[model samples]
Target chain A: MPFHPACHSYEPVTIADRLFLDLRRAILEGELPAGKKISEPELASIYGVSRGSLREAISKLENCNLVTRRPNIGARIVNFSIDQLMEIYQIREAMEGMAARLAAKNMTEAELAHLKSLVARHKDSLLHTERPAKTDYSQDADVDFHFCIIQGSKNQRLLTMLCQDLYDLVRFYRMRLSPAFSSTAMQEHELIVQALERRDGEMAELLMRYHVRASRDRAKQRLESMSPEELGSHH
Target chain B: MPFHPACHSYEPVTIADRLFLDLRRAILEGELPAGKKISEPELASIYGVSRGSLREAISKLENCNLVTRRPNIGARIVNFSIDQLMEIYQIREAMEGMAARLAAKNMTEAELAHLKSLVARHKDSLLHTERPAKTDYSQDADVDFHFCIIQGSKNQRLLTMLCQDLYDLVRFYRMRLSPAFSSTAMQEHELIVQALERRDGEMAELLMRYHVRASRDRAKQRLESMSPEELGSHH
Candidate 1:
């Protein structure tokens, strides 16, 4: 139930760290745009940082799998592809399902109460909204819901893998693939929380995996229905 | 099954890439020693590379989670800990379980035959070995067995996450722990392959998870029985 800015726990202590974070946000929010080449000199001048710091930041980005640096072609913002997105969902289904299972056994009493409150808040938000699917509130709430469970799992490596490395791409895709919110997802969240509350790791894992796979299917259906121009403009 | 040197698939393309691979090998093989501070200038001279290339290699090491860098404190090879090794096992249980499930669904007939042959080769090696538990062949065979299934998953991101990122840490632990091979583990591998052969994704995942959990328990028992000096000397 702890929240960190940019959904990352690491604090920026150096110029390169700060630049990495800022650039990370830029890419996540679609400010830099997907599949776009990173112009070293241009970005350096724009951010008012030296090329050394920028390069360091770029390396950090590469670590997050946000940017791909080619041997000769330089770095580019990771292009959006349905296949890549589906692959991510497959990963999330596995990792987050394990996270939920662990959280059922490992989460503290206070953490369970916090998660309950979060789910309640999301439910409340859903009831008050006339257009819940279009609201960014739904997306943020869903992310918060997942993050709380991931943290509750109490596995540092799992936490780092999901939140620090994979979640960035999760956000990137969510931003570009807007309308990720659905009442069905909220209901799925409620069931997962219920399983967690019972301290049922098996049920928790099953429900979490089900939720993620359903979301993947929903997104795939949406993407398949969208025209090329619509898909291109969605970014 | 496709094999790569040093258990890593990436082919080095530049001075820094080659240096990164070399340093990565040193760290995994215990040549650099666990928990040792990385002296930049010393390593630069040792590797006959410039400070810039060495720094780049060190950064790459950080990405692999093989080195830890602190602000102003410099980088150090990641120290081995029982808790961390157990955590890695938990992660492998989830990711590799999913890989087995997907491989059951996705692997081609030829790939399946290759997997069967790999398992047979591992079984043959186990049968002939005087000390199957101590020989590095058992370890390599075990790694090859997992790598083949992981490749068969046909999920590029999953493959990269497991092979490129997590497997480095896995091999690091195996090298430091030594005697990671066991007939018990080979039997588990055989069961997993049988499930894969039948294309029972559900059973494959269940068996793989059981295998990983059993390995974790075996490792924990071994670690707990060792004295602090024994542990230190083992590294």
Candidate 2:
């Protein structure tokens, strides 16, 4: 018989890794609302991790600007002020534009074919779907289309920074898509795809910037309409 | 009697924090160099930290895109290829442009005064100096001037991301600056200051973009001229 592997049955999960993934998912899914306090002991109990491990995880989040930690007070989810929102948009405008331009030049043939399929599926969904399905499918398609462009850019640093900055914002804005806005978004995606197909780098960059700015305006409008109570509760 | 603090008291530094700052400084100061392998046990010994703490720091640095960690193999510093560099500059062009635009609208009286003083001080240095000072005062001035614009924008997220991305690039490129470039940089700073003073957001944005692009070109030229051995040693 083969010798038993040493310590084969004793693999253990690291507390810090567990807490990092748990908190990241909560923020992405909006289970942890913006500006909510995150107590170390509370998180440690929930994740079955020690306080030391939880603190490490929170430090990582703070580094990403997903959470803010004070020396004595503990950590909280970050809430963007209006001015911060604008600044985020400025970075997004530049990054998305570069992604589009690079995608035009460097996207693989298979990636382009996949993007075409996504666009077609989205169009079909719009034509036959009722109320909520249309919005959901449109939002999913928007993310998939942009994801393709970013991957095509093949710039790891750019992709990483953009994902960290815009992940939550994209999720929040996607939930508020009106039919009018959805249709407009589909049209913008078509323009970007067409430019990429033609390998027109400059035009692709221009269209991508315009598309992000337009989406940002819609999000701003929705944010402005919310009551202070609603905003506070979310935080 | 009042209790006195214990003599010869020692506060133990956490392993994670020590590793984090050491790795961050090494990357920023080009000590480790781009594309160099980072061994965990080696770093642990160097910093007198444990493997667990070193891993935690590596995780954070990976999140920052300053290091890339593989599963079985360890981490390595990032080496951005030419295409990646172009993509980085494209993003910078848009962000620096937007920063200048925002700075024009929002720069405080005190900040404007400080910017003017920075320019005047640099001008005096250029007039009086016979050679480039052993220390790069120009780099300090450049950082201060750009930081002024970033702060004026009052966009925390934008400021944070730009600081991480472009600021590091600026520091890396500073090593290659010649006396000729120093004078040229001063002239460009004057143009930017004048544009800001007139409250011409468009011109300010345009000039800022031009300034960043010129810097990128200079850096590229310097990089191209170096032999592989020279590049390895320089980093």
lDDT of 1 by residue, B166-214 (tens): 8888788777564757888988998998999899999999999999899
TM-score of 2: 0.81
- Model 1 misplaced regions, further than 4 Å: A1-11, A133-135, A233-235, B1-10, B133-135, B233-235
The docking category that best describes candidate 2 is: acceptable
For model 2, the superposed segments whose C-alpha errors exceed 4 Å read A1-19, A172-181, A231-235, B1-23, B30-64, B71-73, B77-87, B169-182, B233-235
Query: Which pairs of residues have clashing backbones in candidate 2?
Result: none
**Candidate 2 structure quality by residue, lDDT tens digits, B1-235:** 1001121112325556456666766776677777889888888888887887788788767755677765466788876565466656767777777888888888888888989998899888778878766764666667777878877776666676676545555454343334234677778889998999998998998899898888777767776776656545433
Query: Candidate 1 deviates by what RMSD?
Result: 2.7
Distance from true position, residue A197, model 1, in Å?
A: 1.3
- Judging by TM-score against the true structure, name the best candidate: 1
Worst 10 residues of 2 chain A by lDDT: A1-10
DockQ for every model comes to 0.72, 0.35
